[model samples]
Target: MIFYIAKRLGTGIVLALLVTLITFLLLASSFEDVARTILGPSATPETVTGIMQAKGWDRPVLVQYFDWLVHLLQGDLGVSVYTSLPVADSVVQRLGVTLSIIVPALILTAVIATALGVWAASRGGVADRIAQGVSLVGYLVPGLLLAIGLVVICAVQLKWLPATGFTPFSEDPAAWVRSITIPVIVLMIGGIANMAAQVRGRMIDELRRDYVRTLRTRGIPPRQIVLQHALRNAASPALTVMSLEFIQMFGAALIIENVFALPGYGSFAFNASLQGDIPVILGIAAFGVLLVVVVNLLTDLANGWLNPKARVR
Candidate 1:
């Protein structure tokens, strides 16, 4: 198990490096005109050249990347050109806000998906068909549209929740929940659909296995066999889907944040990219890639724990 974990961590590190390197190269290339954006249209040629040279933008792409990489290793993500704040600090603040919404939504999604999936798998009648239809619709709907619709119905018309804006959890816990509720629901809808579908399919397959039949023939109760035996074997695939869906939820947060006017990593990245704020943009990109890698690693570990056979590989 230790060896497997080490291997997964090593692979995750390599993938993170490659992602950062590729992102750096792409951003660097597109940033050739970045000095103009920073200095404005009225700035003269010599002014732009001087500013670029002073900021090390005139250096070779590889040289700039190495310099940034060195700073990154030392725990410095560089200073944001727009805000003049350390990129790491800015990202950390936004990340915390984003996670406040994501974590709870994830927990809710898991509980709801698992229960509905297991029940549907066991019942396999009208409930199963209904679950399948809902999952299909949920998976197909765009998150931005869902968020907007919810805001209109719940916030605008019904006046039950705030239409836009965020309140920090520290400021007021109740306001924080009310602020994030719509967005969380938007994220949960798709995640629950995807995870539940995967869990349902896997549970069905596990139920049809020979061991399940043997357990039943041995006088084991259906509920016990399904919950204890079948569910365990089915968990690996459901976990895999959940991990992938979590990443997707993060991506969806980009649009959702804009729709709801939340200050989060997604909004930070979006504004940074538009302004050609390379440092913050690169920082956010690297942070996002690292998160995905970490999630994948954790998922692998969880899979191994649930199914010991996986640790052998």
Candidate 2:
């Protein structure tokens, strides 16, 4: 198991490095001056050249990439051109906002989706049909549209929750929760559908296994057999889907963050792109690639843990 995990970690590191290098190359090849982005076309050539020199954009691409890579290794992720804030600090400050909503939203999604999946898999008739219908509704609803609808219904029309923006937990915990509650709900629209599909597919497949029949023949309670035996055995596949869903949600969070005006890494990335802030854009891209790699690594580790056969193979 340890060897398997080590191998996965090694592969994940190599893949992440490759991603970072490719992103660097793509941005470097653009050859646009950062000063033009910041100062407009009226800016003098000397001013543009000076800004590029200050940014070390005149250096060899490979040298610049190596310098950036070294800084990343040393925990200095560059500075934001627009904000003048260290990229690492910027990422840290906003991480809590995303995590607060994502963590609870993940739990909510898992519980609700799992319940629906288990109920549908066990009932296998009208109940299953109803569950499928609900899942379809969730799947069809685009996250941004759902967020907009919620903003109007809860914040504008009913005057219950705040439509957008966030409050720091340190300032007012209640307000913090209140602000993110709807945004999290919006995030769960696609999450619930994806998780339900995973759970139902895995559970239904597990039910047909020989051990499931044996457990029933031995007079085991139906609920116990389904929940304890079948669910546990089916967990690997469900987890696989859950991991993919998490990656999808993270990517979607960019749009959802902008809609809700939340100060998260996703929102930061979106704003940076609009401003054509190369350093910030690259930093955001690197962070995103890192996040996905970590998630994938964790998923690989979990797979090994859940199914020992995977470790040996």
Candidate 3:
């Protein structure tokens, strides 16, 4: 297991480095323009040149990259061009807000989806029909539409929750929950829909395998055969789908945050992009790549544990 984990970690590290390099190169293409944007239009050419030189933009590309990478390793993501705040600090603060909702939503998604899927596979009838209906609704209904409708019913009309704004958990835990409830629900629905379908399909296939029949013939408990053997085998694919869903949730969170007026990493990144704040943009890009690498690495580890055959390959 240690060896397996190490190999996955190594691969993730390499992928992260490659992604950061590519992202840096893309951002570097307009490096000078970033300085110009910072200095404003009225600044003279010499002033811009002076600013660039001070920032070491005059250095070789490789040198600048290495310097940036070193700073990143030191937890310094540079200062935002517009806000002049440390990118790392801003990202961490906003990321906390995003994760507050995303983590809970993901947990709910995993539990609910796994249960619905396993139930549908084990007892095909109304359970199967219900799971299928959920899958169809998840596929057809857009998250944004659901969020809007939820706000209208739950927040606007019903007044059960706040329509906009967020409260920090540290400040008021109950208020924080109320603020993120709609957003979490929106994210959870989409995730459950996608992962439940994947899990149900995988579970159904696993239960039909010859091993399952053999186990049944051997007088093994039905629950043990289904839960321990079949579900374990089926989990790898569902886990993979869940990891991908985690990434997709971040994308969807952008729109959901806007609707709820929650200040999160998505809203922060969006505003940074609009202002072309290169430092913040680059910082966000690096964070995104790192996130993907970490999620994939975790998924690989979980898959390997569930299916030892994966460790060999």
Candidate 4:
């Protein structure tokens, strides 16, 4: 198990490095374009040259990359070219806001999806068919459209929640919930659909296994057999889907944040890209890759715990 964990950690580190290096190279290749955006098209060649030289853009690409990497390792993500703020600080602030929404949404998604999946799998009647239909629709609908529709119905017409904007939880918890409700619901729909499908399928498979029949023949209670035996065996796949769902939701938050006008990492990265804020862009990209690696690693460990066969190697 330890060896497996170490191997996964090593691989994750390498992948993170490669992602950051590729992002840096791609951004560096567009240095001139970035400079033009920063300096304005009306600026003369001398002005561009002066600005580039001041920013050390004249350095060799390898040297620049090494410097950036070293600084990043030391927790310096550089200053945003557009915002004139430390990239790390800006990203951390925005990420905090995003996490506030993501954490609650994730918890809700996991509990509700898992419950619905187990229920549908156990019943396997009209409820199962209905769940499948809902899951298909939820998964097929585009996130942006879903978010907008929810806003129109729940926020605009019904007037139950705020339509746009974010309020920090510190100032007013109720207002924060009201503001983030739509975005969280939007995130939950897709996550629940994906996770529930995986869970339901796994649960059904577990229920059909020989051990489940043996338990039933031994006069074990149906609920105990399903909950204690089937659910435990089914957990590995469900966990895998949940972990992947987390990554998906992280990516989706980028678009959802924009739709709801939340000042999160998604909006920060989006605006930074449009404005050619290289430092901020790189910071967000690096953070995202690291987050994926960490989540995957954690998921692998959990899977190994749930199913010891995975750790045998």
Candidate 5:
């Protein structure tokens, strides 16, 4: 187990470094850069050169990337040209905001998807049809449109919650949770739907195995057999799906963040892309690639935990 974790952690670090190198290359190649954006038409040649030299933009792209990668290793993400703040500091502040919505949403997604999926898998007739139909509704809807619909129902019609923005959890934990609940729900809706489908498919397939038939012939109670045996075996795929979905959710949350006016890394990345804030944009992209690599490696590790057969040292 220690060896497996060490191997995965090593792979994740190497992948993250590669992602940073690739992002720097892409950012440098782009026509619009922070120096160009900040300098605008009000620049003399010296001023332009000064801005480039100051940001190390005047250096060869490879040299700039090497310097930037060294700083990243030392936990320096540079300064945001727009905010006049350390980019790492901005990301740190915003991470809490993003997790305030994501963490609870993930819990809710797990519970809802597991229950609905198990129930769907157990039911074979009209009941299964009903559960499947609801999953379809969420799966087919676009995240932005669904967020808009949720706002209409909860904010406009029910007047149950505020439409947007964040409340700091430290100052008012209860209200902070309250402020984020609906957005979290909206954020998770599609994820839960997709998870339900994956879980249901895996559970049903597990139930069809020869061991399940043998248990049935031995007159094992249906509930015990399904809950203890079936769910354990079936959940392996669901765990994999859940981990990957989280990686996707963070990237996909950009549209949902803009729709709901949430100040998250997703929203920050979206705006950075539009303004061509190369450093911030590349930082966010590097973070996203790191997220994907970590999640995928963790998912591979999870397989050993979920299935007794794959417990490599």
Candidate 6:
């Protein structure tokens, strides 16, 4: 198990490096333009040149990447051109806000989606139809439209939650929960829609396997066979789907954050992208890459745990 985990970790590290390299190369192609954008139209050509040289943007792309990588390793994400704040510090603050929504939503999504999928597959009648119907509705409804509808009904009409703004959990846990509730539910709807379908399909396939038939012949209880055996095997693929959902949720959260008026990583990244803030954009890219690598690593580990045979592979 330790060796397997180490292997997965090593792979994650390599994946992170490769992704960052590719991202850096793409951004570097127009590296010189960043100085002018930051300085604005009124800035003289000499001033732009000076700024570029000082920031090492004039260096060879490989040299710049290595320098940036070194700084990244040292936990220096550079200062934001607009705010002059350290990117890491800014990201950390906003990341907390985003995680406040994502973590709970993802946890609930995994549990609820798995249960719904398992139940639907095991019941194999009206329950299955109901689950399918729910998935279809979730897929058909645009997330932005869904978020707006929720804001209208829940926040505007019913007055059940705040319409916009956020509270830090450190200051007021209850208020934080209330603030994040609607956005979290919006995120969950998409996650559950995607993951539940995957789980249901995998569970159905597992239940139809010969091992399931043998278990039935051995007089294993239906619930035990389905939940303990088939569900465990089925969960490997669901875990993969769940990991992918984290990235999708991250993208979707950008739109949701705007609708909900939440100050979060997504909002920050969106603004940074618009302004062509290279330092902030690169920092965000690296951070996002790290997150994806970590999630994929955890998914691989979970798959190994669920199926010991995977450890050998």
RMSD of each: 1.3, 1.6, 1.5, 1.4, 2.1, 1.5
TM-score of each: 0.96, 0.94, 0.95, 0.96, 0.92, 0.95
Q: Deviation in angstroms for 305 in model 1?
A: 0.5
Overall local distance difference test of candidate 2: 0.82
Candidate 3 worst ten-residue window by lDDT: 23-32
Q: Give a tens-digit lDDT track for model 4, residues 15-123.
A: 9989988898888877777888888868888888888898888889889988989999999999989768888988899999998888888889989889889989999
| lDDT of candidate 6 over 61-101, digit per residue (tens) | 89988999999999999999888999999998888888889
Give the Å shift of residue 107 in candidate 1: 1.5
lDDT of 4 at 73: 92
Off by over 4 Å in 6: none
Residues 15-113, candidate 3, lDDT per residue (tens digit)?
988888887777777777877887887878898889889878878877888888999999898998777899998988888888898999999999999
Query: Which has the higher TM-score value, candidate number 3 or candidate number 4?
Result: 4
> Top model by TM-score, which number?
1
| Candidate 2 ranges beyond 4 A from true positions | none
Model 3 residue 98 CA deviation in Å: 0.8
Lowest lDDT sum, 10 consecutive residues, model 6, at 29-38
Error of 1 at 115 (Å): 1.0
- Per-prediction tally of clashes: 0, 0, 0, 0, 0, 0
Model 6 TM-score (2 dp) = 0.95
Q: Clashing pairs in model 2? A: none
lDDT of each candidate versus the true structure: 0.89, 0.82, 0.88, 0.89, 0.80, 0.89
For residue 40, give model 3's deviation from the true position in Å.
2.7
Error of 6 at 105 (Å): 1.2
Query: Which whole-number lDDT from 0 to 100 does residue 237 have in model 3?
Result: 92
Off by over 4 Å in 1: none
RMSD of 6: 1.5
Clashing pairs for predicted structure model 4, backbone only: none
